[model samples]
Target: MESRRTAVILPGRSYGAYVPQLFFPMLAAQRRGAEVRALDWKRLEELDTIKLDKIARWVSTQVAPVLKDCDPASTVVIGKSLGSYAAPLVARYGLPAIWVTPVLISQDVVDGIKDCAAPRLIVGGSADPVWDADQAFQLSDRVVEIPDADHGLMVDDLARSAAGLGKLATGAEHFLDSIGWTTS
Candidate 1:
């Protein structure tokens, strides 16, 4: 956060209208004095509903251009659970990003991120079913384990990892520092 900018995109989950991860991290990041931006992606939550690839690509187009205009080096993108679909797409523009419980069940998503160069912070609760902590470790050099977090990142049962993002962020920021991005 060299210029104190942190932008996040909160796309909806794949199944329902309102999943549990609505406002916690956004508020947390805003509270931390980081600027945040999000996409209201709930309207398109249906699975197998007409060209989902095109829709995902539409999201990428919507998100990338604004962030690109902002100068990606000044921002950090945060994606949680199914909403994490947009993480690597944004990463292509070269901004560090944080992914919390990313539901990367598809191999295509894995292939999409095969050559990302930005720092990625992965956070997940050990008990999370949809996404696991081990999977997070497999995805990035920076990983954080929350004792009981779930796909719903900060429910009463998931707060351990929610609160743990700060501690994990410290390590991630440290890694960024080691590579020359001194963020506080």
Candidate 2:
């Protein structure tokens, strides 16, 4: 039998830890009996000054308890932008993941995602400067790219952005289901 799973959301520097709509993907995991929680990091504004290694260390410390208690194979990390730096820690444990608008430009982030052995999903936008669509494809075939969307996956038109978010939610559901986390 599969072990009890946990879905940890490591939000971007600007993302809300508890924003219901933005995290519809986590909702699917919750319905599947996964314990879901969002990590609230301190000193986010200072993230710009800190090196990637330091940020990674801080994130690792914050997520230590979850990794310690849960089955690593069943731990699913959902990280975005700045939070993507934590992907390596999850990879080290061989956990599945969903990276939203990841910092594709960062070699460390790309390498971490590349090293992850479990199921993974990458979501980004073509217009996002930091999003490397090709690199994302190379890392994981499970990818969602929003046309014309910017770094935050927001396009010029609000309707387009909403549509993109809806797509992302659908993709998230599919990814979770593929990993055997679905109620179905």
Clashes per prediction? 0, 0
The global C-alpha lDDT for each of the candidates, from Candidate 1 onward, is 0.57, 0.82
lDDT of 1 at 109: 46
- Give me the runs in candidate 1 sitting further than 4 Å from their true place: 1-4, 14-33, 45-48, 51-55, 154-184
TM-score of each: 0.67, 0.90
C-alpha lDDT of residue 13 in model 2: 75
Indicate which candidate wins on lDDT: 2
Superposed by TM-score, candidate 2 places the C-alpha of residue 129 at a distance from the truth, in angstroms, of: 1.3
Worst 10 residues of 2 by lDDT: 13-22
**What is candidate 1's lDDT per residue for 61-120, written digit by digit as tens?**
555655666556656666665556666576577766666666666443454444467777
Error of 1 at 34 (Å): 2.9
Cα lDDT for residue 92, model 2?
84
